[model samples]
Target: MKSNQFKIVIDDTREILKWISHISKWFFPLILAKNIIQATLPYIHILFGYLILDGIIAKDSSSDIMKNLYWMIGLNLGLGLLHSFLTRLLNVKTEYIHHATKAEIARKAQTLDYEELEKKESLDLLRRAEEGINSNGGIPSFCNTIGSLITHAITIVYSILLLSGLFIAAPKENATVLERVFNSPLPTLLFFILFASALFLNFKISEQLNKRSYAFFEENVDTNRILNYFGGVSNNYNFGKDIRIYGMADMIQEEMNQKNDAIITMMRSLGITYGRYSALIEIVNQFVIFSVYIFVGIKAILGLVSIGSILKYVGALIRFIGAVSSITIFYTQLDLQRQYLNNYSLFLNLENKKYQGTLPIEKRDDNEYELEFRNVSFRYPNSPDTVLDRISFKLKVGNKMAIVGRNGAGKTTFIKLLCRLYDPTEGEILLNGINIKKYDYKEYLQIFSVVFQDFKLFSFDIGQNVAASIDVNEEKVWKALEQSGISERVKKMDRGIYTNIYQNEENGIEISGGEAQKIAISRALYRDAPIVILDEPTSALDPMAEYEIYARFDHMVSQKTSIYISHRMSSCRFCDHILVFDKGRIAQVGNHTTLMKDEKGLYHTLWTKQAKYYN
Candidate 1:
């Protein structure tokens, strides 16, 4: 990792620790205890092995040997049982931490400012953050780094202390390793040298193999993307129709095969090259083990060292090497997990561009809300041209306005600004004579109940979907459904108000497009805010159906301010006033009859064209 990346990783590590601590106060101590026990088990077993070997080799009495044998059996059985218990407890702890961290991530994503969430870069950041937190051992990119460090440090220190006895020459004399190698027939110094050289070479080879494998996977990520998207279309229910009707099976399969072949070739190249080095490392390890055993056996044969000494020395050497190796590998794994932690941290730490307002919108029983857009001009972030330029409008209680425009004419942009999804880049919006930004964001949002062109309905019970809450007002839900003209349809369902709107055969409930639209409209009605917006919610309905929806919607918005966006002139006729837009500018604004009579106006031109199309 680069310096900046490493900094991010460290920052993330601190944050992760904090989050884990917040979720479970005992989690860190628990992990540390478990790891300590795990690390000590091997040394304890090794000590028991030496005891057993010494008791037998010394030709001790039968009772002594039997006691040693019982100890060996008890050590192994007890350690195994202890390990199993710790593992189960750790798994539960990890699972609990993961759940808590995931919930935090979810809350962060949902509560992010609307404009930030809409930006592509922001969305990508959020996605990477989500992946980092959702990955294996992934709670805020969970890595047992601190625990591993503690465990390995203890193991290394203990193993080194044990091995210190063997490295010293016999007769307890001051010794250089060279003197020991000359004194011993086994060439002890050369054995050390060979082991050191083998370990160094093995480390290099292992590092290269890991690097190669990482590069291979990273290179193929985009290839997998193409394969998953187009290749797996058949598996995705949403794309099943295209696969069947467009005869896309063969094309998708062929593309998938080609992508897979490329990925497989990369995999093969990595395995072939890295496998040789891995095999070499294993061979070297085995050679070291074999040499150690032979030397120890020769020493025992010469009666230079007892059977117990042989077991102790060899076991200590094995433990030392393994601990050292684990320490080295632990650093690498820690770095990788740290990078993932970096992404998660970056996402959570992202600052909102727009500062949150502190002022509160005064509560009024009569719902006296006024929205005024004064010289508002907005261009999306990183865009050259303004989507809504120099737009100004005013709306008060008991007003219904229709916004008419062709595609890309800023009809939706106006709605977005009105709803404060994105603030105007150049001017302020006034709410009841004060800048909307001055009022509390949450309080301001409560004033409007909007159903956008691309509205979403939940796969929940009818009442829940309409009320946007599980604890629904049954009578209110039915009234809203009636206003949206979907009550009778819902009444016929198996569960009535509690019926699932979208589900499979188990639930056996699915609604048509028009029916879904009505449900969305019902959602707006249930909110019953002072300002209402229906941005082409009836687009899927026929002209007569659209008119009926408009008629019902007008009745529903009785005393509330309303904004209706539609391309169909028939829907515009239902509004008290119509605002015609062309290329982000308002071309005309008037009642329907006046606009239609003015033949030279943009509204007249659009109205004529739409009426002709409908006819």
Candidate 2:
């Protein structure tokens, strides 16, 4: 194993030990006592059998001998019952501890960053965590196996001691023949070799099976995405009619079938591999057992050993083989668990490189704040071309700036930089003559309230979703709703603001796309920040509703710094400044009237093309 692999195994062992220490403090003494009682009972059974056999062989059927034998039998039976009860009690206690530890690990996983979880490498690690928990049914089972293996090893030692005592006591009898027969080291060594080979083969088979299982899991994840896409066709209000007219059900079903067939083929191949290895291991185990039985039977037929001595030797050998097998199996399981721990360790070590230096930003004393981009340039991580190239512009506080651009004109990328989602690749962005980098990230985000076209709505109450992370009052929530022109629709509902918005759960009420967008806008307004960004917020609404929403936007955000992005040319009429972006640079900048006068400008070409629809 590599050094890192060793470290991960060591960490996992420490985790296991921590759990063991906790359970031992409370239940260890009880477990140890129970195991001792269990181990003692097996010897008690052996003693009872020895006394009865001796009485029969000697023809001593006296009343005292018979009575003593009956008492021994009763005591042995009681001890057996006690052993069974304690085993069940230990199993239940171990299960409880396992579930508690799994819960703690799951909670720790949830605290990880959302972006880190979305990475491709992280997905496989997450899958391993799932499989590890499933394989052992939780952490406690892993620990319980170690404890039970230890207990069984102790039992094996006790059985060997009892057998040795029996051989010494029967030295003059034919029963002493078994002690001489097994005393040879050659037979014991052969048994160990065969069993070890079989165990190693079994481990190889199980590891291959686990690898195939994970491959199937990953393929199913892709299949689920396809299913979700098709399931939306019939219920999507915007696309349902188009789908019905096109009759796309057969096409989608065929695609889904192809994905399913691919998974089935991989599973069949795995099953074949597992079957071949399993059969070979089973045959080897059977051969080892047959050889042991043949050698012992020859001695008994030759009158070299008594029937009782032969029975005792066979029992001891079986118990020893069983203990060795259990240890081998546990080691294999430990190896598999270590593989999962390594994956989890990788996930926890995901890179989160922090920005080195901070840029200074002047605090605004007045309501107005000036923003500037000084030769700003930027590119996304792992991408070659710059999305914004040497772009420079200025916006006065409380000014409504309309940014218009054709598709792929770098309009959205420019806004993303202003929001500081990704820092500039080359140049700097300034707020009040200070680099925005100097301000705290969270504090900087608080300066603006934005609603993008692809905004997400969580499965929460309408009011809570809008006033995100803030203590919301009913009066303020309703006021924001009223300002966004969605209060009338909300007031008509029976549950009003408290109604859940997801349709999958009981009592959840689903709203229209336009209504969802309005709720998003209401959330942005509730923030009451100085800067507001609306990226095509009214795209899903009707023409009349869209115009009315923009009219309300102008009134409600009158004295705030507003940046509006839209394909609709008419929306730019109310803005004090309009910027037309071409490729990754600013092509033109002026008020609507001036831009309209320049026929060669990109904005003029776009407006002329749109004006044809009205004509």
Candidate 3:
């Protein structure tokens, strides 16, 4: 087994390489060229300055100096224009990468198995990934991290080599203050070591500061989770009426203020800690710059180099010091960025258990299919209690089944297993006399059209919403809407079946509760799958609308095997079989007449209590 530390290390390494490949493929070569040109510009500027100075100081005609000055001005102007153009290209590249990377992550969330969404660990990883590079501190962004690393590293190395050549003495000269130190190779080496060491220390300290800044988000995830939930509730249109009538606005704001206080405290602490890194860097820069100036001044006094050379050496040394510091700091930032990448990579690698099957659900004229749950048991991830214990049942071809149960009696869990949203913890589910896992996960899903209690409607055209595709058949869409009893309302709209289902403009359609429920039913009908499951699809409708559906339930379901779940026991009279669930077990299974006769059974007791109001 791999250790936790080892696993984290591997995840970070893989993520870095993956991002590098993506960024480099688009802009690495161009960025490298830009860096190379930018790197040479400083040295060229220094050289031109020295040549102009030498010409001016040589006691020659002023024409020579004028020519050198003109050349220097031309070089500076050309370099400025080039830098501006390259900077714009860099912006365009980084922005494109940012958008593309975010879209890729969103796509991954959409494709992930539904079961993974329930896991806390998966959700936490997803949040950290969303916080993304550089949002909290120095975390690297995928689009620009590689380019930055390459540019900084190249600049530092080339500056070091260029600065080394300046150390070689010209000749012996008249005695001057501190001339011995400038001529001594050992002193120069000592100063170089001190400058490099101080710069490294600053970088090391900054990286830790950056890591702590981002750590606040992960540490307070639970608090932020509640903050986000209540915050969203305040903005939700569905909760607007409740917020006003119940006077919940002030209450939610107080809760948000409490969470905001925690965020403020964390940021304050991080800021105080980061202040120390800045102080240390400030001290290092002062010492390094002062030392370089004194050494260069001594060389000039000793007549080892001209006045022009002195200016060149001092300017180059100052810039060289900055380049070295920047490179070291860039590396430290990359290290911190890798941790965020590890979080993203772990989420991307989360287990996916779909589509292990080779077989397809066969096409049949009569849509003949059979399903059986063989001693199936299930418990949610990280839960100890079984949600559905040893559940066994069968739905033969063309047989309608009704599941009756109180809340938390495992009705939804049973449907989830049948649809393979999750697999049973023990035993198996079989379709067509074989284990259901042997069939293509998507193909198996195609066998059923389930209208869940919490169905959602999108703001799309009526036909696309019903058909689940943009390339929809208008004829079938109308036929399905007609069967669901919503055709008349849809036909009266300005665009008929092509009308938008939600308000966008003056003529856009806005549906009532019953109309929306019927549209949901239309969506199920348009799928035309082999099996139909309706989990209280008509709960939102009026009694008359509900009666209209019950009256045409046979025509709506047609020959397809149907499963209906409802609190109203009267609905069970329409089905061939009723399965009564109590305390995660099937307490009884029979027709309504047979179950109602047994006074001791859970269903009979429930039926008697509910039947009182109607009687």
Report the poorest 10 consecutive residues by lDDT, candidate 3.
Answer: 134-143
Query: What's each prediction's TM-score?
Result: 0.89, 0.77, 0.91
- Give the per-residue lDDT of model 3 (tens digit) for 1-615: 336744664467556567645644646555666666677677767877877787678875788877877877787788768877877886787676667657756777877887886677778778767665435332225324545556656666655665675677445667454665566687668876987687778767766775785577567767777887898898777689999999989999999999889888987888888787778887888788898887778677777778887777787788778777776665555556666665665666777766569898888897778899999999999999999999998888778888999999998888888989898999999998899999988888898898888888888888889998989998999999999988988878888878887665445677877788888989999998889888888888754556568658766675889998877665676888999988788989999889888999888888888775444
Instruction: Put down candidate 2 lDDT per residue, 1-615, tens digits, no spaces.
Output: 556754765677666555456545555544666766755665565655655665666666677567767878787778778878877876887776556546645654665543345455566566555555554444445555555556667767865764453333323344444545544455556656776776676556655655665556555655655665667764665576666789876786788678768767876887787688667656766675676577567655655456665665556555655555555556555655555444444454555443424543445656568899999887765568877889998998889999999887888888788887667888888888878878866677788999986887877777788888536677888988999989999998877887777765568787888999999999999998889998888788875677778888888999899998888775677789998988888899998899999999899998887775433
Q: Is candidate 1 or candidate 3 better by lDDT?
A: 1
Off by over 4 Å in 2: 1-181, 200-245, 291-316, 340-344, 356-365, 469-471, 611-615
Which segments of candidate 1 are over 4 A away from where they belong?
1-14, 23-29, 61-71, 93-102, 134-151, 172-233, 294-302, 504-508, 612-615
Whichever of 2 and 3 has more lDDT, that candidate is 3
Q: What pairs collide in candidate 3?
A: none
Tell me the lDDT of model 2 at 63.
76
The TM-score of candidate 1 is 0.89
Q: Write the number of the candidate with greater lDDT, choosing between 1 and 2.
A: 1
Per-residue lDDT of model 1, residues 467-579, tens digit only: 99989999999999998999999988889988876654358477888999999999999998989998988889887788888887888788888889988877776677888
Q: Residue 232: error of model 2 in Å?
A: 8.4
